[model samples]
Target: MSTTPLPLSALAAPIERGTAAYRRANFALFLAGCSTFSLLYCVQPLLPEFARDFGLAPAVSSLALSLTTAALALAIFIAGALSQQVSRRRLMFASMALAAACNLLAAIAPDWTSLLLARTIEGAMLGGVPAVAMAYLAEEMDPRHLSGAMGLYVAGTAFGGMMGRVGMGVLVEIGSWRSAMAAIGAFGLIAAIGFAALLPPSRRFAPRRGFVARHHLDAWRAHLAHPGLLRLFAIGFVLTSVFVALFNYVGFRLAGAPYDLGPAGISLIFLAYVFGMFSSPFGGRLADRFGGRAPLIGGIAIMTAGAVVTLAAWLPLIVLGICLITIGFFVAHSVASAWVGRLARADKGHASSLYLLFYYFGSSVTGVIGGWAWQHGGWSGEVALTASLALAGIVLAIRIEDPRQPDRSDA
Candidate 1:
C-alpha cells in the first residue's frame, strides 16, 4: 500500500455537508453498513439448530458465529492497512461482494466443519468495511456533520443486527436454516451493488507510497499510547464481550427454563434491538451536548441495572432487563466509536481497526466464557458474569478524562 497522502481538500468536504450527491452517498453507505452486519450475524439464531442437526455441543455450535468474528478481528488490521493503497469505495464494494458469496457457500455446506470454514472466510472479507468506513467518512463528510453521520451509520448497524437475528429466526420457521442464510446473502448482494452505484468516486483518496512495516507498527504504538484511546479500547473489549455473552445464552435460558419458549418466542427477544437503534443516535447527541464521559458512565450504569433485572424469575422483568441492556450497549458503543475518531491524530483507519479487533476479541473470548457460566451456574451465573463485566466498563469510563483536556490531541 502506498503512503502518499491523497489530496485532503478534495475529500475534505463532508458528504453530509455537500450537495445532494453527498447525502445520497451517505444513505447508500448506511445501507451497505447495515447489510454487511446483518448478513454476518444472521447465523446467530440458528446456532441451536446447528447443534441439534450436527449432533454438536452448544460450544461447538457457537463456533459458527465466534469463528467468523475471530477471523474478522484478525483480518481488520490487514484490511485497514491495505486500504491505504486502494480506493475506499472500491474496497468496501469488493468486500461486501465477496462476503455475500461466502455466505452462500456456507448455506450449502454439507457438514459443520465446512460451514465453519466458509463463515471464517466471510468474516475475513467483511473486515474491509469497518476498517475503512470511518476513515472514509472522516475524509469525505463535513466536519460539522461527521459525528451525526457516524451516529446514523452506527444506528444502521444496530438495525442490521436486529434484522439479522430476528429475520433469521422468522425465516427459519418458514423454511430451513440454509434458506435463511441464503436470503441474507441475497440481500447483501443487492446492497453491495447499490453501494457501488451510489458512492461517488473518491476525490480525496491518494494512494499510499507503499506499505512500510514501521508505519503499521508506529500507528499501533501511537494509538495505544494515548490514555483516552487505551481506556476506550479496553471498554470496547469488555462492553462487547459482555453484550455478546448475554445474548448468546439468553435464548437457551428462555427456551429451557421456568419460562419455556420455542424458537419463535425466543426470536422476539431481538425486538429489544429497536431500542438500541434509537439509543445509538440519541447517545451520540448526548455526547455532543454533555461530552462523551457522561454518556459512557450513564450507559454502563444502565447496563448494570439491566443485568440485575435479568436475575428476576419473572418473564416480563426479564424482557425489561434485556431492553435496558440493549439501550445501554448501543449508547456505550456509539460513544466509544466516535471517541476513537476524536482521539487518533492520524491513521484513523488503523485506530478503528484496533478498536474493533479488541471489540471482536471480547466477543470470541468472553462469549465462550459466558457459555461456561451458563452450563455451571445457570442463568443466575450468566447474569453475575455480565454484571461483573459491566462494572469493569463503568470503572474504565470513570478513568477516561475529558477528550477536550489539554493533553488530548484534537483531530
Candidate 2:
C-alpha cells in the first residue's frame, strides 16, 4: 500500500510499481491513452464509407488516416522540445482539449476538404501526448516498474484502438459516420476531464524555461548518434509501417470478393486488438522476467509468420492470421518502446519523440504505399511489402543490445 521511492543522484526518486500512488498514476495515463487513440483512430473503419461518400479511390480514401498521422509525426518533434520549457501536464491537457474540439469540428464539416483540414489540425494537437507520455513515465516511474507501466499504457492504446474502430462500425450501421464521429468526440471530452482531474503533479520533472534551440538540438543529436537507439528507431519505423499498411487496406480486401464483409463485419476484425491488449502487458512481463533480446526477436518472428498465414484465401485462417499479427506487433512495440526509455540516460523526451517520429512516419508513408499496392497488385502485393518490412524489423531488432544498466531517474 505504501509507495517506494528510489533515489537517483541529483534527481528526485521514482514512483515504484505496486503502490497506491503508482496505481493512480497508471490509471490516469490509461485514460489518457484511451482518449488519445480513440479520437485519432475512430475514423479507420469509415474509410470505405469515405470513399463512397467523397467519390475517391482507395489510395485517396486512406488519406483520411495517413494525413493525420503525417501531421502528428512532424508536430511531435516540436512538442517534445517544447515540453522542456512548459509544464508537461498542462501541455498534454491542452492537447486533449483542443483535439477533442477539433474532432467535433471534423464531425460537422460539410465537405471533405473541411474535414481533412480539421483532422490535420487535430493531429498536430495530438502530438503533445504520445511522446510526452513516454518521457513522463520514464522520468517518474521506478526503473524496476517502467516496463510494466509502459505496457499498461500501450494496453490502453489497444483498448482504445479496438473501441474506436468497432464503435464507429457499429454506430455507422446504426446511423451515419458523422454521428459516429460526434459520439467519439463527446467521449474524448469526458476522457480529457478525467485525465486532468486524476493525474498527479510531476515529482521527477522540472520545467526548464529558456528559448535555447541548441540544447534541444544537441539532445536530439545525442540520441541519433547512439547505435542501439538508432536501430530501435529504425525498428519502430518498420514495425508501424507494416502494421498500419495491413489495417489500412484490409478493409477493401474483405469487403469485396469471397469475404464480402460489411462495415460492421470489417469492424469485427479490430477485435484482434483485444489480443494486442493482452499481449502488451504479457510481453512486458516476459521481457522483465527474461530479457528484451529474445522477446523482441520472437515477436518479429511471430509477425512474419502471421503475414504468411494471411496470404491464404480461407476466411478462418485470415482471421487467425490477423490475431497473430496484432499480438506480435503490440508485443514488439511494447518491448521496443520500453527499451528506448531505458537506453536514454538523458533528454528522454527528445528520445521518445524521435522514436515516435519514425513510427508515425512509417504509418504515413507505408499506409499510402500500401494503398497503391492494393490498387495495383491487390492484397498479395501489400502482403509482400509488409512482410518484407517485418523481416527488416527482425534484422534491425537483432542488432540492438540489451542495456548494460537499469534506467537512472534523472531528466
Candidate 3:
C-alpha cells in the first residue's frame, strides 16, 4: 500500500490512450469478469431439480439461488471497503479461487440445506471481484478507453452468465445436476488461474492509510449529493430486480402450463443472453457518441416493451421478448455502471460496491417474490410484477436530467 499520492498522468499511463498492451489487459479482465459471473449464476437452471430432490416448494427451492445473491449483496460493501487495506490483485485472485472451492463443496453436499450454505459462502467470496474490478479499470485505464474497457468486461459477464445458465442446463441433461455443477466449478477454477496469470500487476492502485467510519460516511454523502449517481443507483435496483424476477419465474411457467418443458428445455431459454454480449459493447459506444442519458432511457423503454410481449402464450413471441429484454438489460447496465465511475469523486471502489449491492439486493428480493406471482397469478401475474418494476425504472430515468450544465453540488 503506497501512502504517497502519484500524479494522475502517471497512474493512468499504463494503458496508453491507444495501445496494444492496454487492449490486451482489457481483454484479460473481460475474461476474468466472465469467469466470475458464470460461477456465481451457474445454479440458476438447477432450481427445479433441487425442489424435486429436496421436497420443497417453488419459493423454498428458490432460496438456494436467492440466498447466494443476498449474501453477495451484503458482502460487496465489505469487500470494496476492505480493498482499501488489501492488494487488489491478491484480493480478486483469492476471491475467485475460494468461490470455486465453495462451488465444489456445493456439488458434494448431501442435502439442500448443506448446498444452500455452500452457495452462501461462495457468494460472499465472489463479491470481491465485481466490487473492485471497475475501480481497477478506472484507476489504470485511460479516460478515452474507459467505456470501451468497461464494455468489454461487461461483454465477458454477459457471456459468462449465458454459459453458466445454458451450460448447466445442457450438462444436467446428460449427467446429474451435481455433475453439471462440478463441471462448471472446475471451469471457473481454470479461468481463475488464467486470470491470475494474465492480469498485469496493478500499476495505479494506492492503499488508503486506514479504514475509518468517517471515510465511508463521507463517500456515501458524496455519492448521494450527485443527482446522476442517485439516479444510477435507483436504476440499478429496479432494472436488476425486474430482470431477475423475469428469469427466476420463466422456468416455472414454462415447466408447468402449455410448454411443459423439462429442465434441459427450460435451460435453453438462457440462450437469449447471447444477445446481451453484443448489446453491451454496442451500448457503450452509443453512449460514447450520443450521451449516456438517451441510450440509458431508451434501453429501459425497450425492456419495458419486452416485458409486455412476454405475456403472450406463443413461444416465438416469448423468445423474441426475452432477447429484447436481454439486450435492454446489458445496455442499461453497461452505461449505468460506467456512469458510476465517472460520477464518484473518490473511493470509486466503494461506489461500485454500493451499485452492485443494490443490483444484487434487487435480484434476491424480487426473485423470490416472483415465485409467488407465478404460483398465484400465473404468467400474467409474473408479467404484471416485472412490467411494474420496469415502469418505475423508466420514471426514475426520466427524472435524471442531464448533469452537464453546472448546478449546485448540494441540491
Best by TM-score: 2
What ranking of all candidate models by TM-score puts the best one first? 2, 1, 3
By lDDT, highest first, what's the ranking?
Answer: 2, 1, 3
Report the lDDT tens digits of candidate 2 across residue range 1-411.
211122356566788767777888888888888888998898878888888998989768877777787788888998988887777788888898899999999999988999999999998999999999888888888876777788888998899888888878778889999989999998888888888887777887767756578888999999999999999999999889888888878878899998899767887888999998889878876776666777888888888888889899999998888989999998999888888998998778899999999998788788779989899989889889999999998888888988544333321
Residues 1-411, candidate 1: write the lDDT tens digits: 544574555444546444786677667777777887897889888888999999999879988987888788888878878877778889999999999999999999999989999999999999999868777766666544555556667788888898899989889989999999999999999989998988887666675777787887888888999898899999999889878899889988998857789878888998999998789878876775567888888988898899899988889999999999999998888888877777776777888888888898888789789989999999999989989988989889898877553222222
Query: Which stretches of model 3 miss by more than 4 angstroms?
Result: 1-10, 14-18, 52-60, 110-113, 372-377, 401-411
Q: How does model 2 score by TM-score?
A: 0.91
- Point out the higher-scoring one by TM-score: 1 or 3: 1
Model 3 weakest lDDT span, ten residues long:
402-411
| Runs of candidate 2 exceeding 4 Å displacement | 1-8, 48-62, 372-378, 404-411
Q: Report residue 165 deviation for candidate 1 (angstroms).
A: 1.4
RMSD of 2: 4.7
Error of 2 at 70 (Å): 1.7
**lDDT value, candidate 1, whole model:** 0.83
- Lowest lDDT sum, 10 consecutive residues, model 2, at 1-10
Give the distance in Å from residue 145's predicted Cα in candidate 1 to where it truly belongs.
Answer: 3.0
Question: lDDT of candidate 2 vs native?
Answer: 0.85
